[model samples]
Target: MTTPQWAWAFEAADGTPVEGTVSPVFTNRFDAEQWLGQGWREMAETGIASAVLLAEGKVAAPAVRLSSDV
Candidate 1:
């Protein structure tokens, strides 16, 4: 079986976490990244400020901020 990965979504305006923000377990990083790329914009509109990628339950890297500046 493939390894599992996760992502956490939070409000950028105040860092407040939204409920049901955790993504379904992904089998690979590429799939997880692609999902975020496609959905982050919608999340941002709903108050998601950034997304934190996790590998095996630990942080994979810094959180990705969804801003127009980037």
Candidate 2:
């Protein structure tokens, strides 16, 4: 079986990912996703308005807003 490559898409307040290179590569999709789940708040604190999970170089999940209420 081929292990999946996972990456992050960092977005701005307007909900668009800032144009640039993708994040560091992750070997395990689960670890990548869990890291995002745990770190998104901190990312938002640092001006990352939103984020999404990328599976094999494509959007895997809907965008997740910084706020929990969303």
Candidate 3:
């Protein structure tokens, strides 16, 4: 079985950002969001925001009422 992960849709060269979730193509789900959050905080400390957590990938989290939002 494969595990799901959280990933952000990144654009090259300071372009627009799209909030999405995707697992690492070749690895297990290593809490992608956790790492992303940590990375983001670390960058914040260094004043270099290269990436942003567009979405939280929770394989088991509750879904929103898409009927209203979508």
- Best lDDT among the predictions, by candidate number: 2
Q: Ten-residue segment with the worst summed lDDT in candidate 1? A: 5-14
Off by over 4 Å in 1: 9-11, 68-70
Clashes of 2: 0
TM-score of 3: 0.29
Predicted structure 1: lDDT: 0.74
Clashes of each: 1, 0, 0
lDDT per residue for candidate 1 within 1-70, as digits (tens), equals 7657565545455666667666767888888889888888788787777788888888897889886542
- Model 1, position 51: C-alpha lDDT score: 80
Clashes of 1: 1
Model 2 bad stretches (over 4 Å): 19-22, 68-70
What lDDT is reached at residue 48 by model 3?
Answer: 35
Task: Give per-residue lDDT, candidate 3, residue 56.
Answer: 42
Root-mean-square deviation of Cα positions for candidate 3 versus the true structure, in angstroms = 9.9
The worst-scoring run of ten residues by lDDT in candidate 3 lies at: 61-70
Tell me how far the alpha carbon of residue 59 in candidate 2 is from the true structure, in angstroms, after superposition.
Answer: 0.9
Colliding residue pairs in candidate 1: 12-49
